[model samples]
Structure formats: structure tokens, C-alpha cells
Target: MKKLLQTIILLFFFSLTSTVSFAQGYKIIGKAIGFADSTKLYLADVTDGSFKPIDSTYIVAGDFRFEGKLKHKVVQTYIHTKNFADRVSLWLENTTVHFSAEKGKFKQALIEGSQTQNLWTELNKAIKSSKDEKEQYVQFIKKNPDSIISAYLLSLFSTSWGNKTIRDLYGNLTPENKTTSYGKNIETYLALSKDIQIGGSFVDISQPDTSGIIRKLSDLKGKVILLDFWGSWCGPCREANPKLVTIYNEFKSKGFEIFGVGAETSKKQWVTALKKDGLQWVNVSDMKGDKNEAALMYNVGQYPTNFLIDKDGVIIARDISIENLRTKLKDML
Candidate 1:
């Protein structure tokens, strides 16, 4: 009995020591099953439509830890496993967060220790349980006008909700909420979305190719040009490259062309990715990441976005799925 009592006491102290509070930064203590030791996991900042992996760690004995100081006050992030085979979103701040899950079940993990995450989880649960998700979402925003989560949600749906709805939601948000990066993106989307409507005249862009020669959108005037916006850091973009290649190859002989605009922060990374992905098409960028002039003109908040321009340079389709694109090409080509 005494030995058992001593063991329990040791565990109690160990638990206390494991989660010591820090003056600044965050600590994530995690455990998982069904993963080998040394399996790498990545932490990425997913805030404001950006996908930047800031850190990574390898699991050891089903356990891992990540703690670091933020350059600024960031509120949200993502944990990616197996090069994004699975992903789980979390709120990040100066606190200790606990995570545990079975391998391949990261999407179901509870990111505990963040108030914002708590609210996010609660709202998601309510939305999932409710039949009228849109109604619930609207009501939540109306009630929580002061919450940053509401601004985040409004920004997320700004594309689907249209400009008027985004403006209404944005107006309802508190001043503090309106100052976030999400809010600014919402404003930008509202402004830029007006000119880039379906069936509208395609916007013209000019940027330097990997060889430093300028390329213009007008160059592909008579071809079915796909203006693809992607990034070197985007896992989905990299994964989709092979399929893109197949599509390009199948349609290139029939007056189809892919004009890829890489949302790259570094020229080296962009060139390397181009080589690795074997994107055998005209790719261009300003090496300014998302701030590329073309990216801004199109309001490209996320990667893997594309515009489909017909022979006359009219944007006939936007963000169509690969299967739909194939079908469309079959008819048009």
C-alpha cells in the first residue's frame, strides 16, 4: 500500500512538472498510438489563409513536445502528420496545450488549453448537431459580434456568402475584431471579387518566368489557359502537381496551356519545387509569396486556386474540380 501511494505521489508531481507555465510562448505536449518513434510531425501557421510550417518534431515512444516563442501574438495553427496525410487545427498562444490521439485520427483530436479553440470546438459541435448550419452560423455571429471567431468565420465564407453578406457581417463585428488579419482579408476579397466574377473578362497579369523573362497573360490569347496559383510550401499543391501534369499533357496538343503562378516567398524554393514537380509549363512569379501582384489582383487567399480562361481570354470557369475540368475540356477542346 505504501509503495502504491508513493508511486501515485510521484505521478502527481510528474504531471505538475510536465506542464509548467511559461512567461511567453507555448508548449504542446502530445502522445499518439500507432506511429513509430521518429515519425515527423509539423506545426504550421494557418492563420490568414497562409500555410507556413514554422516548426517540426519527431515522436519518441508515442510522445512529443513542441514549445517556442512566437514572433507575434498568433492565435491559431495546425498540426500536420506524415507530410499532411492528416491535419488537426488548434489555437496557439502562451499556454500549455495537451494532445493525444490514435494515428490517422488527428482530425478528431481535441486541442485543449486554448480558449479560442474551446469556443471553436463548441461552435463546430453546435453547427454539426444543428440542421440549419447557415442559420446557426448567422445567429452565432450576431450574438458573438465581439468575438474574433465570428470574424474568422465570416472571412472563411466570404467567397460563398457573396460581397453583400460579407459586408453585413463585417459591419456587425466589433472594432477590435475588424482589425485582425482575417478582417483585412475579408475587405480585400470583397473589393477584388467584384471584377473576377464568373464569365467576366479575365484579368491580365505579367510576371517573370523562372528564367527571369517576363510573361504576359495575353501571350496565351488563343489557348484554353489555366492560370494556376500555387505555392512551394503548399503540400496539396505539390501533391496535385502530377495530376496537373497529366491534365496539361492530355490537353496541351489541343490548344490547352497551363500558366502557373507560384506563390513563393523564395526564388530558390520556387525553382526547386518546379523541378521536383516537373511542371512542364509556363510558370511565373514575382517571388513575393502571396503578395505577388497577380495574386493580389485575383485575391488569392489560398493556394491551388485557378482561373480557366477560354480562347478569347474570358474567364469561363473558376475553381472547377479536376473531374469537371476534364469534362469541360472534352467538350471545349
Candidate 2:
């Protein structure tokens, strides 16, 4: 189930390429070559490490069209065919754009009409031709300090680039650029990451459980704990629940406990998953979705992140698998 709903909003707009046409938000007139008729073309958002299709169309006589208005002025999307072939990442704006590319060479396709797309094209070209990709990225940021693209690029690789380098690059961006959504998230992540790490005592997390009673992580002191950061929408988290149940049943009687913190967007879905998965352990959420307080306190960037705490509340393991948790529990208890 995708988070975004598909709504055909018919508004008024003037198209220079066509006569008597109507579109309010965004319009992408695409000409796809080397694809058979009825091939599906999808515009998907993979920002949160999940594949969600916002709009899609079928190839009719080598032509395809996708029209939708983004809530924001600028957003990122991946245009692809069936099985994600000919995938091309493009930054879209609320403007008309044309995409003309061959079957597998979508990356080299001619995309115009949006200034953000133009910048993306230039940046991609430079990155592809450079010997050291990181250096090229750094140079790009330095050159375009005021560009929103720079901030987004920095945030995109914040995890892989490490905190120091990301901070240095971010320091070079202008105040206006730093105020973008991506830049603000990076700032928040960096600040929160400092408070949580291995060998450090676990931070206290408070959220309402299924019964609407608030529970605190500090209350689980003196017991071996696994602080799991997960969501009901995450596939891997659901699949790992059964194994986690087995692990819990084994060592639960030996002062072992699992503190499940859900980074959920909806309370109904969270409660449903808890019941369906038979999660007997204490599960809690603030129901703030990506803005979840517990998730941000732990600086969780992806789903299914966990930390194993010792009896003294010191973080002993950063992300231990269920099997490893069992093994460690057997040795400890």
C-alpha cells in the first residue's frame, strides 16, 4: 500500500506544444523509444528507502505522459520502465518538461524545461566524468553554494560521507540553501547523532503504548534490552518479527526484554501490525511518522535499526541480528 494517493486533478494551464490542453501542476511529455506498446512507465518516490509510485502511464505508440502537481515546488523522482529498467533520476519542478530517450540510455536523455533538472544534468555529467567522485561533489558544492541542489546532494550522501565531511561541506552552503528541507534534516541528524552511540548509555524514550499509556525506556533498567526502531510499513521489519518472537520467548524469562519503538505515520496501522504480528513485547510510538520523537532521538535514518543494551543501560551492540542477540544472551545469562 503506497502512502500517496493518485488523484487526477484537472486544472487549467496553457501548453505551447499542444493545443487546447489542461494541466495545473506538472506535465511530463515523454517519448520512449525501444519499448514495446503497453510498457508501463512509472514516476516513483524512493526518498525514504521505499518504492512508492505516485503516478504511472502505459506506452501508447511510443508516447507516454505523466501529469501531477507536487506539494512542494521541487521534488525528486525516478522515471523508469517495467522492472526499473531505463531508470533515470530527475529533479522535478512545477513546470512543463520534455523527456526523450532511447531504451537503455535514459541517463543520457535530453531533459529540459526545469532549472533544477538542468542543474542535475550538469552535476551528473561532472560526477560521471570525474576520477574521484567525492572530490567532484565537493567542488560542485563549493561552486554552487547558493543552489538548493548543493544542499540536497550533501544530504543525499550524508551517511556515506560521514559527519565531519558533511559538516564541512554544509558549512560552505549559504544560509538560504541551508534552510531547505534536506539541509534542516541534515542539521537535525547531526545534532541527534551526537547524543547516541555505542558505549554510551541509552537515551530515554517516552511514547504511548497500545493502551495509550506512556512508557519510558529508562523504566526497563536492570534488564538486558533490545531497543528496536522499526515501522509497520517496512517489509524487512515484519519478516524479522517472528524470529524476534522466538528470541524473546527463549530469554524473556531471564530478565531479557525488547523495547519496540515504531517510526510510524499512522496509529491505526501501528496497532494493527502489533496485533497481527502477535508482538507481546512492549511496543510504543509517538505517531509522528518520520518526525517520530524516539526515532529522531536515536538518529534513525532507516527502518529496522536496533541497539542492544547491557544490564547497566550501556549500549553494547549497535545493530545485532536476532541470532547474534540470542547467542549473546546465552553467554550473558
Candidate 3:
């Protein structure tokens, strides 16, 4: 009786743990990649934040099926194949995902979900409006004196557009124009006001590793840190990895270190890329794209960007080249 009771208790505990694990969500299918003979299906947990991959299965004859609990939220589904534009779907509940394309050429895209269509429509409109607002602000700044609106508009352009065009325009503004309210607003926007760049000075000292081990930036105060933002599947970023590795090896012994922050949603992909690229450095990823705290804090509008911080945690460079990075590091070291 005692042994049977213990067995039941163990099973109950196991069931509870499994339920909790599935709390984030479940999926029947995920990313499908590779050619016919080499095809494979990926299963992912939706709520893991970093979109860490959970499991994988092989597909045969262009058909695949797998089962897992569904979590509530929108998730991305990609079908990757060579010689063809990868098929993508924004999957939600109560719908079997389907794909169709023209003969011999699978590069075409077709989505069947009404909800997904609606979402994309709204997104496109927002993008158009944002672009229009940017243009209006530029012309408005040229003629008007500085005001809070002009300052805010400049911030919007830099943070949203993520280009050099507006910054260049601001620089070319006449000295007489600089004296206007518009010029002052632009200047204030470029320089971080006390309240705006909150906690920009304080490095996150209490962030825990994947293992829940707490580590702080100040703990490695003497090291030159390269805060890298990248993604596993990004081809350009992967191209840059080899160069970064070379630099890291050269300067690692000279008080230099790298802290890579990936935007990959899958732990499996993240780990695979890390090993494949020979990235022997500390790394983390929230897997949430724009929802990442660091990305929001730093106003990262694009991938493959980085900040070089000195030993004292002061940002020394932004969006620079490998040659420039090497030169800067040599000076610091």
C-alpha cells in the first residue's frame, strides 16, 4: 500500500510539472526547412520569450504532422527551402495551416487566414503613416523655430526610421537656424536628457543567466565589453561573426570581452549557430524581437548593431565597422 501510494504521488507531481511546462503554449507544427530528402520540421514553445525551440521531427513527401499544446498569442511559422522563397505563416488557433504555389516555382506566397490578413493590413497602414509623419516633420523643422513637437519629431525619425538621412539633415541646418527653437529641439533630442535615457548609465547588475545565476556588468568592470545584437538566421550577421571571433581572440587576453544578445526565437537555433560560428562568449536573448528590454532601452531599430563600452561602462562607439572597432579597442587597451 505504501509503495502504491508513493507511485501515485510521483505520477501526480509529474503531471503537474508537465501542465506547467505547457502553460506557455503548444503547437502542432513549426518551421519546416530544407530540401525534399533533407526536410525537417521544428516545434517551438511560444511563450519562452526567446522563442527557444522545443523539439523537431522529419517530414517525408512534403507532408508533416506533430502535436503539442497551443498557447494563446500570434506566432510565426516559416517553411524554408532552397531554390524557393521560403513560405511563411502567422499561425493562430482553430485553423489548419495550408500552403500552395505555382508549379515548379514555390517562391509565391499565399495566406488563407482572415485574421492574419487583417493584421497585415493594419501594419501596412501604420508603416505608411509613420513615413508620412517623418517627411512632414522634416519640412516643419526647416521653417519653424524649435518647439517640443519638433524635438519629439526628431526623436521619432531617428528611433523609428533608423537612417542617417535625418541626422545628416539636422547637421546641415544653418547656424542661424540652430538658434531657432527647432534647432535647439533637435540638439536636445540628440543629447539624452536626464529623464529620457533613464538607467542608461546603470548597467544591469542583477540580470540572471539562463541557469538563474545572477551576474552584474560591474562584476567585470575592467573588461572592454562589446554588446552585440544579432540573430541566428540572419545571413549578414553570421558573415560578421567570423570577423568578430577573430577580433575577440586577438584582444581577449587584453581586458576585452563580448556579451552577445541574439534575437533568435529558438534556443536550438541559437545554440546551433553559436557552436557553428565558434562564438565562445557569454550570450543572452529574450527572443521577443522588438519586445526585448535591451532593444527598447537602446532604441535598436535594426539588427546587427552594437555598442562598444569601456571598462567604466561608458559607451565609446555605436554602429561602427570592424576596422574602427579594432582601432578603438587598441587605443583603449
Candidate 4:
């Protein structure tokens, strides 16, 4: 009887311990004013531009709650209604997060939680009024190298700073921080940025032309290449096509070629613009718009960007004016 009693006691203790451990995971206690009773709310884990539902609950009165655990120290999570048209996003950490919002004022929702969220809030306020917000973010990243907020800030200001500055800031992150999604993205961007900078060899790209025929940039290696990243919907790109056409006419017989990569979403619109603009150059696109592989590979953020590559495939200049490009061509060819 004594042995059976001891075994029962151990089992009870183990059950209690497990329950406590499970309860210690991250918890979000939310209250939405004017929200209808039984309104469905969803919690989604965001990674690699995709959403995976984690847990869900419905508002009983104006209150709802979610409690769960995450494997990582921090993960980007979103909370929204069933349609997901309106949502709130925050970093979910092992802490109690308090959220409050009005029915139609989701953007104005109040999120109070971990140190990282606090820092993010502070930075957002500073960004609105600060004249030198870039420097403010740089300092924050420097001071919070171990924090996930640093990685988030790095992503926001990555394109604003030069490659060397980005590299220096990224190098300050902790080993654990370097393993996060944003950190890995920074590493990849830095490597690609360095390889495509002025004086570096042009990175070869293969994309589909308008008719779905694949074309390789390397096929035009023996000619002076103007690698243009543009879109049919871009006003500046459309305006600049006439100038490019003139340049092409002047240099076509002199071993000069323009490889125009269109960052377009719709194939029909892209084809229409190509014919309308009379861009008689080699045009190609993967029809992925902003997420185009060629655009991402070259780190082309702004529209109407061009890189002038020599016959040997080395980038000579980037984003030069038409007159400057004409002068350079006269000098080279």
C-alpha cells in the first residue's frame, strides 16, 4: 500500500509540473472594443513571406486571449480576423503581451510587451520627427546587437545605407542573432551587394523573354552591355525609353547592346508597353514584379536603374545620365 501511494504521489507531481511548464509559454491577452461577440480571431506565425496559423479563438464579450509556445526566442506573428485584410503584427517572445484595439481601428491598436517591442515603439516615434532617422536607427542597431529589434531595424534601413556601412552594422550582431531569418537575409544581401558593386564583374542572369523563351545575359558577353532594370508601369522608366532608344540607334553597330529586364507582374501589360514604347532592344522578364529574381539578384530597388558593363563583363558605371552615358560610349567605343 505504501509503494502504491508513493507511485501515485510521483504521478501527481509530474502532471502539475507539466501543466505549469505549458502555461509558461507566451500569452497574448487582447481586448477589442466594439468587437462583436463570437468574432473569430486568428494567430498566425509569419516566416519567409508566408503565414501559418498557430492558434485561434473567438471574442466572448470584447475580450479574447491566446497562449502558446514558440521554438525560437522571437518570431514574427500576426493577429487578425478571418479575412486577414486588417491585422496587427508583432514579435512574439516568451512573455505576456497585452493588446487593446477598437473594432475599426486595428492600426491604432496598443501593443505592450517585451523589451524588443518597447524599443520598436520608441524607434517608430523617433523616425517620424527625427531629421536624421537613419543615424538614429544605426545607433539603435549598434546598441542592441543581441536584440531581434536590431535585425528588424537593419532590414528597414538596409537600402538607405551603403554596402560597407551595412556590412559593418551587420557584423556587430551576436552569433545567435545572426542565425535569425532577418540576419540570414542580411548576410545574403551583403554578399550579393559586394559582387555587383561598381568595378565588380556583372552577375549573369537568365530570365524568360516576352514569348517565354529563356535568355542568358552571358550570351552578349563580347559586347558593351547596358543592363537595365525597369517596369512597364514605372513612369520614369517609360519616359527614359526614348533617350535609351536614341542611344541604341547611335551605338547599335558599334558592338553595344541593352539587356532590358522588365520587373512586371502582368505579361499582357508588359508586352503592350514594349510595343508602345518602341524599345527595340533585347527585353526579358520573369513577370514576378518587385519579387523578380533578376531585380533581387542585382539589388535594384529604384526604377530606371542601369549598369554599364564593359565588353569583358565588368561594371564600369551605374545610374549614369544619358549625356554621361553617351560620352562614356564615345570614349570607349
lDDT of 3 by residue, 61-108 (tens): 555555444443344444333322443333443344444433334344
lDDT of 2 by residue, 1-333 (tens): 232322222222223324433235789999999899999999987555346788989998889999988876677788987687689877888789999999989887889988888987887888888889889888889999987788888777765566778788899999877887878867875665445779999989889997899999999999999999999999999999999998999899999999999988778899999999988998998877765777766767687999999999999998898888989999988
For model 4, how does the per-residue alpha-carbon lDDT over 180-278 read when each residue is reduced to its tens digit?
887876776676553468998999899989878899999999999999999999999999999999999999899999999998878999999999999
RMSD of 4: 5.5
For model 2, state the Cα shift of residue 173 in Å: 2.3
Q: Give the TM-score of candidate 2.
A: 0.74
For model 2, the stretches where C-alpha displacement exceeds 4 angstroms are 1-27, 34-60, 65-73, 78-88, 94-96, 102-110, 125-136, 157-164, 288-291
Please give the lDDT score at residue 301 for candidate 3.
53
Q: Candidate 4, residue 175: CA error in Å?
A: 0.6
- The global Cα lDDT (0 to 1) of model 1 is 0.83
Instruction: Tell me how many clashing residue pairs each candidate has.
Output: 0, 0, 11, 0
Comparing 2 and 4 on lDDT, the stronger one: 4
Task: Give Cα distance to truth, residue 258, candidate 3, Å.
Answer: 1.0
lDDT of each: 0.83, 0.83, 0.58, 0.85
**RMSD, one per candidate, in order:** 9.6, 10.0, 16.3, 5.5
TM-score of 3: 0.48
| TM-score ranking, high to low | 2, 4, 1, 3
TM-score of each: 0.64, 0.74, 0.48, 0.67
| Better by lDDT, candidate 4 or 1 | 4
Score residue 137 of candidate 3 by CA lDDT. Answer: 60
